[model samples]
Target: MAAIASSGVKPITGMLRRGLILDLSIALGLGFTFGSAFWYGYHMPRTNARDNFYKKLEEQRAAKAGN
Candidate 1:
């Protein structure tokens, strides 16, 4: 009886450890995905050749305000 209890406990402990590792992997993956998206968005090239619609609107507003 004591041997059976100890044997059952090993599998449960191993499964719990694997679950924690899987959780860490998933969290890191999500964090990296979000972090890369933010880096890409923040690092986009700034050029007048590109038609930035919202930027144009803000510029027009500023021009109007100055006038």
Candidate 2:
């Protein structure tokens, strides 16, 4: 049955093409997310405010021990 075979072939080919497109799109999205995270972390700014806070905590601990 040539007609039946042709009909089956069409749906199979369409599904395979759609699957490939979906896979490629998902891969691109993941790549973008990872790339942005890496870029921001690598270029993060330096701040001394956090360092000062930790230093204050250490000072408090030392004072408590002396008491």
Candidate 3:
């Protein structure tokens, strides 16, 4: 009984499959969109780069003083 069940579940010949090229193309497009968003956020001058740096520096100074 077990052998018969295992044989039924085995992969049949010519049943192998490969990813469609179209699916890969769609994934590449989504990656490009997310990458662009990250690039824009990191490099945009209007973003709070200076404020964030000063905030982190203050934290470090406070930590050093506490220790």
Candidate 2 versus truth, CA RMSD in Å, comes to 6.3
Q: Lowest-lDDT window of 10 residues in candidate 3?
A: 11-20
Q: Give candidate 3's whole-model lDDT.
A: 0.77
Runs of candidate 2 with Cα error greater than 4 angstroms are 2-10, 43-67
- Which digits, one per residue and each the tens of the lDDT, describe model 3 over residues 1-67? 7788778576565544334566777899999998888878675644678778888999999999995
Q: Give per-model TM-scores.
A: 0.47, 0.47, 0.36
lDDT of 2 by residue, 1-67 (tens): 7788767445555787899999999999999988878766653432355677888999999999995
Task: Itemize residue pairs with steric clashes in candidate 3.
Answer: none
lDDT of 3 at 59: 96
Show model 3 residue runs off by greater than 4 Å.
1-19, 43-48, 51-67
User: Which of the two candidates, 1 or 3, achieves a greater lDDT against the reference?
Assistant: 1
Pairs clashing within candidate 1: none
Error of 3 at 47 (Å): 8.2
In candidate 2, the residue pairs with backbone N, CA or C atoms under 3 Å apart (3 or more residues apart, or in different chains) clash, namely: none
Q: Which scores higher on TM-score, 2 or 3? A: 2
Query: All candidates' lDDT scores?
Result: 0.77, 0.78, 0.77
